[model samples]
Target: MPETSLVTARERAVALLGGEPDDATLRRYLHGIPGVDAVGLEQRAAGLGTRSIKTSSKAWALDRIISLIDLTTLEGADTPGKVRSLVAKAVNPDPADATTPRVAAVCVYGDMVPYAVEALGDAHGDPDAGGVSVAAVATAFPSGRASLEIKLADTAEAVAAGADEIDMVIDRGAFLAGRYGLVFDQIAAVKQACLRPDGTSASLKVILETGELVTYDNVRRASWLSILAGGDFIKTSTGKVQPAATLPVTLLMLEVVRDWHLLTGQRIGVKPAGGIRASKDAVKYLVTVAETVGEEWLQPHLFRFGASSLLNDVLLQRQKLRTGHYSGADYVTID
Candidate 1:
């Protein structure tokens, strides 16, 4: 086949799966996936971390980082007022500065989706506007210990409540127990539940929660498993785990997405959640995306940072770039 035809064929095959997999077939596929080399992966990540981005480029990256944030608040004590405030912050990250770009999405718990949708309506004319997608964490979020039925319902409720994106967690217990098929099927089912009554489906982000996975090889396997099961984005963590979203873990995920695109002609996204607090750390992630997967994944459609405090630090950096001095916490909203 011609190269173009081959690419088209692979895309067609991937689209047919729609994020679910046939049990036996998916199991066989999972078994065939190769493992990762811990030393090589960590060395590459460390080397990439050493690349210095200059002043102008750093300013450009700060702006892009602002746009890529999935400003999140997934606490049990979350209230409607808190969700509304977060929605406001997501719509306008910097009230004092008009040049600052809006975040990619506002991620909240399933129950808060309605409140976020309502609050965001005044900010943007359409709920599905590209400026800020309302993402909800479902599937027993943070811990994927719920039954499959409850998890699917959790996803459906979020979608029905007006979420444009669904971030679901994979069952680490099942994965660790060698029940790859169960993990694959649960993600597939949740992906299907993301469909709205109007036939549109919210983008599905499968959170691997790499902190619990314990090894680079497991992370690689989970990343590929999520992709083959129809995940639009493979996320690094739920932000609840201790070692969430480290450089090496995220680097492995970036490599997987890059390789998946090469093999399937489908481009999946990556989000590194938890512990990515500083502007410098965010810039390092952007550098990884640019170097590992090229500039195409630099956009919000293919990349995201699932963070809350990272936004304010990014705002501070943006201010520094604009006025040549550091800004205080009072300059940015306290969401």
Candidate 2:
């Protein structure tokens, strides 16, 4: 939707709710959601993934994938040096190919946000400014087990350190146990925590840990819950789960986003994290996003890929597309 006719996000959300956010209303609305048809959903996803892109579109898709990457590093062994290296690659993905597009952001741990911000230097603004953003995983990421106060503190510190985005994990345990209100409250709180002293808030990407959600119905519910709680993006996983991201799950989430846009005229973002390691697979996701949402959603704001090794594969494929043959392993740096 265009920016001019759009109402405030808060106004749209309130209109959707019909009243203030509370446990009873949340439960009634979520439970009232239509159940997913697993068989039909899987078939639709399969069909979309099988649609092949022509050679002309493949080149564009490769570059789009590069721009949508979050360039993530969330391991325990992460260091300031590693983050700087990651930021360097994010800024100039292919040193030999200056034309290669830079990635969207460098995602790091909360404590490492400062180093990422520092390393990004002048090239650390919006993608439109020819700069890559610094995204941080906060609120006890990948495992939302911390208290509400701790989660807010985690979010605040990252925002203070200058993270452009916050990828927070929702408490799946609460969601699973039918404590929908608890999960709702926590996500809303974390969204508030992302607010900066300067009045602008960091974008909030609510991680559903979809693998743990187990059912497509839960994925749908959680997607709606996160959006209702003011998440700028609804993410799939934490990269620590068995099934990090899959076409079917991502397609389902996109469907929710599509529906929300239909009702509110506001478009939310979606990030499919983990297990997307190949350029070809990434192309399939691009196709999914375009077909499901629209061609415009291929941009950095509406969609993102939480990836570590995906960039290398994309860079290699990019070289092949330009040079007409696959490049050697040494061409792209290995993470």
Candidate 3:
């Protein structure tokens, strides 16, 4: 396929972001959304310990967990070393501080995957070491405004450079303009490029940037469309928007996947990125999956938390449970 025109694509993406939604559609998206209930959400977030233990055991035993921890702290150019250390910590967790769950993979921007892959390679001797998969953000990430060819080549290069997973954002503009076929074709092409040189395929995660879509109906339609178009996972955001990943939005996507699975007998994954900072917040997302998507999606293959700061709180909470002391500075900062 020829490269899409970048100038045109960017204009289309922006227009879609600013478009209006009608009444019934707006109502559907807002369905059952509680009053921004963080307290209630936290109350529902009680199972982090059980979830973490389950993740560790499943990963150790059946390798069912995604065992994921993400790093998209793109500060300056000195990021390679930072990412390498982050990956290392996720694998060989600090023994003194037992809060970090064994992550299944280390995810970074496309430019940083090679550094993480090398670090993970150095730490490959540990049993914890084997779970180190790599995921790279592609397709003009936070803003899905790149040409289709650039997106495909971006995915291809990441896979070739050793990313075990490719997370691409759907062109929300196309979907908003009622061009579902264009969006679908773009995703399919990228999925094709995600294939390894020898014909194996890396996991392909499609980020809908749900907040950008701005309505529940759009979120639902995008979710369903993404799954039908061959998305192995449907992610919530680029973590760069005002409303990155919200429970209500995730709830909507959960329904889409639930119905999709019922209809097609195929399970798709969910990733809620952006604004997920605290360990409690991460657990809330897991609880949402467990309650809405069923106990099965709680495992990593069907679920993952995409955040840079979340691991520390998870680790801190874990340490408090294990050693009975709330020692601060238990984890290294991503910055």
Please provide TM-scores, in order, for all candidate models, with all chains considered together: 0.89, 0.93, 0.75
| Tens digit of per-residue lDDT, candidate 2, span 90-148 | 99999999999999999999999999999989999997456798899998887888888
Q: Alpha carbon lDDT of residue 321, candidate 3?
A: 41
Q: What is the lDDT of residue 295 in candidate 1?
A: 87
Clashes of each: 2, 0, 8
Ranking by TM-score: 2, 1, 3
lDDT per residue for candidate 3 within 1-335, as digits (tens), equals 11123233233333433332332332333343333343543444443223432333321221222254554554446488888778767775655744344676677888887888888875432223446677888998767898888888888888888888889988877778777667767877787787765656778889998878876667877886676557788999988777888777776678778877786566888888888776545554655677777977866667777877766666555656456563322321111
Worst 10 residues of 2 by lDDT: 1-10
Q: Which residue pairs clash within candidate 1?
A: 19-229, 19-230
lDDT (0 to 1) per candidate:
0.81, 0.86, 0.66
Better of 1 and 3 by TM-score: 1
lDDT of 1 by residue, 206-289 (tens): 999999999887888889888766788999999999899998899999998888888767789999999999987787788889
> Which lDDT value does model 1 have at 326?
48
Q: Which has the better TM-score: candidate 2, or candidate 3? A: 2
